[model samples]
Target chain A: MIEVAGVTKRYGERAAVDGIGFSVSQGEILGFLGPNGAGKTTTMRILTGYVPPTSGTARVAGFDVQEHPIEAKRRIGYLPEHPPLYTDMLVRPFLRFVATIRGVPGKDINARVDRAIERCGLAPVAGRLIGNLSKGFQQRVGLAQAILHEPDVLILDEPTVGLDPSQIRDIRQLIKSFAGAHTVILSTHILAEVTMTCNRVLIINEGRIAADETLEQLAARGGKTRRIALRLARPGDGVEGAIRAIPGVLSVIREGGQDGAFVVETEGTRDAREAIAQAAVTHGWGLLEMRPITLSLEDIFICIIQGEEAA
Target chain B: MRNVLAIAWREVRTYFTSPLAYVVVGVFLMLSGWMFWASLVRFSSLCLQYGNNPYVFNQLNVNDMVVRPMFGSMAVIFLLLIPVVTMRLLAEERRTGTAELLFTCPITSGQVILGKYLGAAFLLAVMLGVTLSYPLLIMATSAKPDVGPTLVGYLGVLLLGLSFIAVGLLISAMTENQIVAAVGAFGALLMLWAIGWVADSATDTVAYRLNQVTFGLWDKLHLGLGGPTVGDLLNKLSVSEHLGDFRKGLLDTEHVVFYLSVVFFSLFMTQRIVESRRWRG
Candidate 1:
């Protein structure tokens, strides 16, 4: 339950967050994809009420961040890029302090702290000084603090930035599990995390949002195009002639090598696989493999940002 | 008010948890003890000579009085220790990134300031406590020595320290550097000390009329305390001046109000500075 309409943050001459707007419904996970210095953190800062937007407004769970900062901030849990930790205190004490300040009930404070500790896998280092903990543990402590009070919405920036692959997987799993119960808006430059964790993606580049939609929709959007790769055993001389006879095959270009493989380049909505397979079998060619080859999220992201810049 | 206490409590815990708290307390006590002993030795000579020591013999001698001479050293302690305490209050947090966590909490900016002030003030009071035995020890050796003045003198010094810490907290909020915060606070305190001097030197009657409003404290000690020496007014307006009155067993309601007012203004300013960083960041 978030509504951000025409929010722009300007610092002197540069517009850090150019007028950009998007909304996240309850139980929805939205991934913010952007390169470094792309205003992703700036936009998240505005949403959390940590800073005021230069123009327009953002509401968290129906409360305006500017007009009612405390109320809005209460309903939204935020983890800033750096984690904003008090390094002098221990991990458990720090989280308890956070819970106290967030106005969690004193009677339930211990239970909440234990729950957050378990959820973030911080039980082992509970009593260790925050400064003494490893970066990965510190990052977990940061996440633990954000979700300690169980806010209605969770806003995390670069949630998996410094973690190892296993830690990253663990955090992503935790984040994924949060979907459909907590509305989360996480920003990252990593494209794969978006495809895996967030159902919807919002691509921001050069201080503006260039693309926003579901993963499937993003892949399906833009010009109508498709590319496929096929592996087949050495075909007879009639292989090209038989493949050309398949309907909706724009160009059946014979691509490379003595292994006799073919990459059929097609246009528009059409599946030429059955015809290609039948043609190969009819000619006594071994049909080994056939798979749909589409653009990965990274390719899509690079293409989107590059396309906008080129335009 | 309660939230302010919670923050202050946390600040206090931080003092002990990090080396910051122990280091500040240690340095403060050592310097306070040094100043007290130095004042005691000078007091012995003053009592033995009974104002007969030649003034020109010692270039440092402003008077044979212990309080006045000690003021010069008190300035150094204020400049040295206060910056250390106030520097990390906000600057370290802003550097470490906890300022955002603090801001996002349910508490307001005002609570943060109050909490920081109280935490620093509590440590300072403990620092002041260690030096308490020195005066009590002073009383043990001499029956005629003024104990009332000694208690009030300590009271005045403590208030002066409170004022410095409060102002230092505000200056600490202005920048993220501990050294800059220390220097800014020292400069501010030094100016307040010099206001009466500048006011006193004005040749023009109009200038005198204008300086009165700015240097009212100068007038209060000279007129209100009704002392018998040239340094009497200077002593009252400068921290050391009122300190001497307390050492001499005098406590004025006006001096008490002056210390409290200074404390209130600095705390309010500290709150405002902390609040501005969010928009400016």
Candidate 2:
């Protein structure tokens, strides 16, 4: 439902969003992963028609954002980093206003607002002033407005920023629920958010797309190399060489400042733990601990970012 | 149009929900009421001074002495209060980042500017509407004033207030700081208000020299361009100069068009400034 090509945004000499391109199919939840100042928000703004791209074009549902902003924006619901809320307004009235401006049918405004309020868990504070709501509730209110019109595409920039763990979980669940019905592109620095809510991940660094892959593909990439931690009760020489001699074992590195502690790398396809434990016992190293290490999404993200930097 | 009304309604609701509308309205009414009472007192004293002479009493018209001065004071009051009303119209949207929500909607920038202008104009209308009671009260307690001049004077004030609002809206759209918008609008309006004085006192200034040259050219060419010189053009550009005909109960199309042009030009410029955001961002 979204196609972006060679989009670049510059402020004088500094390019906030360098030339980049990506597309999200209908009913796909694409997580925009990047560190701060990674041009994630700039790209979303260009797609939403809030800011024109300095060069190139972005389309939403086949409408070019710059050429047909009104039509393009009609199909987009954007939640900027600041939430774009009027603090003096009451929750219900604010949502109603958003619905009206967002072109929700007159007859369905109330129903749509009620649905959004309920969906975002804003029913309890429907009549209260938005200024009086807590940060989490305010963030939810922002989410409610973004989905109020039921737009075909939702561009959320850090939807879960500044929320507590529970609020983050609730928001993630809400985003996950949007899959297969609404095409979502939510940007966040939180790697776990992508793992928990998105089916596909697009890791960006320095205003460029570093890696774009499905969750399973990403997991397989991360899973190709296995790490195992080993601690010995008695210090011994040649422990690293002995571990490396085992089949499927890749390499071994001693943990600094720790006696008889080593980390072992092996091929992800085989079970090298039993072999390593047997080698430790025969070599009289007195193996005390042996555990396989699982690489998290964060580690993968860092690896991609670091790899991009290296290149 | 529905999009415009939606944005307009939001602006009005925001004004009323905060203390801004009430405080501005209350203070405006108090000051205008004081001006009305003071003018009434001066008119009464003048009537007493001329009570003995029928000729002098005939010349001391209530509309001239009372209503005209009252309208003049009301215009000045509007100049003071309109900045307060319109300062937050666009500035607050930028400050709070609601402009993102507004601009990203399926509406044009013209719709947003018109909606906000109409919203502030609605408040201006209400402020003028409540002061209608002043005319009714005058008719009750004293000799009836000329209704034509009084009603036309209200129209004049309304148009002038609208022009002020347009100017204020333009200033508001140019900045994110409300105080800066307010002060900038006040300064601009004051300059527009005081510009007429420059025309009136053009004795040895550049305007006088230009007026002399234009007059000599008109005389040499026998173009018969009577009654309009460079000074006249400067006076015509002054926002306050066009109110004289309305105050005198003469609905001159020229003055009406002048006020309308001011309204149109300011709003048009405001729309341009708003549209520039997408490009500059």
Candidate 3:
């Protein structure tokens, strides 16, 4: 469990994280989505007791990060953007070092580190130097270190920045599997990853939380259906008007372009293909392709960020 | 204490397992060997002219020759070596981002500092131990070596070495650059070593004021919390004063207290700096 109350971090004159507050309940994987310099890392640092917030307070696992730092920190695991790895040390030794510092007994250290190694899929590279490993393996080792202590809260900042597509998917599934045991707050710029792994998404932009809601809620609010491009062999025709009259068609805006196409913006579950088709037959107009446009997560991200800026 | 020891244990192990430790040991043996041989050759040739008799003013050259200056140069070596050893201690952690791991742990900052200090100090002691044989070689050949004073002198060097490592640890925590850490540590130890001369120099203009704050080992030869000599004064002021007594064959309690106090002070300062790091991180 974590509670952040009006947390803000400022460096000299620049505000890294402005007044923002959020909480993560037990067993919930909260996604912290933000563009670069959105103060996501700063917020994560405050939560993990790695850095003090310039103002406000953060509590993790019911302990105040400032007043009870060690206790708060003990409950959480943090994987920084860079992974905080010792390039020289081998994987197993480094994990043992982490476990030792976490107050794990020597006898239990080996077992815990082994379990972490297995959980993070670091078995083959357990004895190799972390610096020599591939980027994906290094990321896994970083993940191994974070969970070595079996912390209740895991804060991973940009966990999959450089991994390949398959590695990213594996990490995503691994993170998804970790949901029930550890309350994870992972900040990433990758929109699809968040959509795939996160139960809830908090879109951060320009040092403020732009939107905080579940995937469905966000999709409903910002996920307008595809704007259908209908081209007809007519100029200044009310075929667009009749098409607008169709059910589930929110609104239609026509544009001057090649072949005189009309941009139809829809707002419901209903696809207007049947209605538009019948209209074309009655109007005796030559119907070109009537493909329904699709908005990807990238489009939604840009829309949300740009929409926030405009507001 | 156990938590601190656990960290210290790991830190000590890292020293031996890492190349930094080997480099430090090799550098010390190579350099101190040169200095020791130079001192020995000077002692042996001078002994030929003096007829192996301890009667050159009966004021033996062990204090004036080998042990005394070795103690002084050890501080210089600490200046050179401590930064190299400790430069990456905390700074590399910060740069590589592993400091977060240390900070987020259940252990206290004091424990971390104490552990790191002991680990590093033990390493220096081991290095000192290797060179101990060289001094023993002198004792082995001497007709009637003043074993008491020679032991005292080595003890003095150990205490002085402790002070340098402690000072070096604090300086290392202040920056990310090992070079800067070395420079800062060197400058600080140099100032401590030269403080006696500076105070003596200032004795002309600020005699009244300098007498109160002047922590010179050479001046206050006797009087301390742990003993009657200036070594005892170390618990209150200048560290070298405490060490100087041990160099002269007096195991004053005050000198021991002085050295321990420095060790604790440096550890305390390091803890505060490491803890305060969270605010900036």
Candidate 4:
């Protein structure tokens, strides 16, 4: 439902979003992961028709954002980083106003607002001034405003940023629930958020797309080589060579500053733990600890970003 | 149109929900009411002083002495108060980041500018509407206040108020700071109001110099380029100059056109500034 091609947003000589291209299919939840100043917000703005890209085009629901902004924007619901809320308005009335501008029919405004309020769990504070709500509740109100018109696409920037743990969980659950019904593209610096809520992740670094892959594909990428961290009780010579001689064991390196501690790399398709244990016993090297290290999403994210920077 | 009204409705609702609408309207009414009472007292005293002199009494007509001056004071009051009403119209949107919501929505910049202009204009209308009690009170108590001039004077006030709002809206669009917008609009409106003084003072010197320069061309071409002097053009540009006709109960199309052109030009510029945001972003 969204396509961005060769989009570069430059301010003077500095490009905030360098020529980045990505497409999202209908009913897909694509998570945009990037650290600060990674052009996440700039990309979302371009897709939402808030700011025109300096170089290329972004199309939403088959309409070029610059050429047919009204039509493209009609199908988009954007919740900016600050939420775009009027603090003076009551929650319900504010939602109604948003619904009106989002082109919700007059007769259906109240109904749609109620549904959004209910969905976002804003019923208790519906009649209260938005300024008086807590940050989490205000964020919910912002979410309600974005989803009020039930647009086909939802572009949220840092949706869960300042919320407490529980509020974060609730927001992530709400976003996860949007999958398969609404096409969502949310940007965040939180790695777990993508793991919990999105099926695919796009990692951006320094105005470039460093990595874009499905979560399973990312797991498999990290799975190509398995590392086992082994600590031996007794000091031993040739421990690394002995471990490397085992079948299916790729290589073994002794860890620094620790006696008899070594990391063994092996083929992902095979298990070399039993063979290593047998070798340790025969050589009188007591196997104190042997654990396989699985790469978490955080590790993969940092690896991708740092790898991009290094290159 | 629905989008425009939605935005307009939001603006109007925002005004009332905050203290802005009530405070501005209240202060405007109190000041205008005091001006009306002061002028009425002065008019009654003048009547008593001229009670026996038909010549001065006839010259002291109610429309001339009371309603006309009241419209003049109201115009001045609007010059001060309308900026306050318009300062937050667009500036607050930018400050609070609501401009993202507005620009990203399925609406044009023209719609946003028009909606905001109409919203403030609605408040301006209400300010003018409540003051109608002044003229109505005079008609009830006084014997012969000309209704034509009074109504025409109101039309003038409305147009003047609209032009002020348009100018204020344009200034508001140029900045994110409400105070800056308010002060800038006040300065611009004051300049427009006082521009006629500069014209009056410089007319002879400037027009004579222009006539000297253009004398040979006019003599050669037999053209009437000498008709409107430099001062005449400057006076025509002054906002207060056009308001004089409305205060005198003269609904000259020329003055109406002038006030309308100001409104149109300011609103058009506001729209352009708003649309430029996408490029500048």
Top lDDT prediction, candidate number: 4
Model 1 residue B244 CA deviation in Å: 5.9
Worst 10 residues of 2 chain B by lDDT: B202-211
Tens-digit lDDT track for model 2 on A84-139? 99999999999999999888989999999999999999989999999999999999
Better of 1 and 2 by DockQ: 2
Across residues B1-281, which tens digit of lDDT does each residue of candidate 3 receive?
Answer: 87777767777777887888998999988888788778768866777777756687355466567765665566567657766666666666666777676776787777777777788878888988898787677776653446777777777777777777788888888887777887888787766655554343332333323345766542475433231333222224665555667766778887777777877788788878877766665
lDDT of 1 at A128: 95
Give each candidate's interface RMSD in Å.
1.3, 0.8, 1.9, 0.9
Give candidate 4 regions above 4 Å deviation: A244-251, A267-270, A308-311, B204-225
> Where does the lowest 10-residue lDDT sum fall in candidate 1 chain B?
B56-65
Give the best candidate by TM-score: 4
Assign candidate 1 its CAPRI class: medium
A134-187 per-residue lDDT for model 1 (tens digits): 888999999999999899899999999988999899999989888887999999
Candidate 2 local Cα displacement, residue A119, angstroms: 1.6
Model 3, A182-280: lDDT tens digits are 999999998888888989988888778888888877766534465688888763567667888888887777777556788887765677788888888
Candidate 2 per-residue lDDT over residues B1-281, each given as its tens digit: 98899888988998899999999999999999999999898889988998998998989888988899888999999889999999999999999999999999898899999999989888888888999999899899767998988999998999999899999999999999999999999999999998878675553444445447886774466544444555666788898889988888889989889999999999999999988866887
- TM-score of each predicted structure versus truth: 0.83, 0.93, 0.87, 0.95
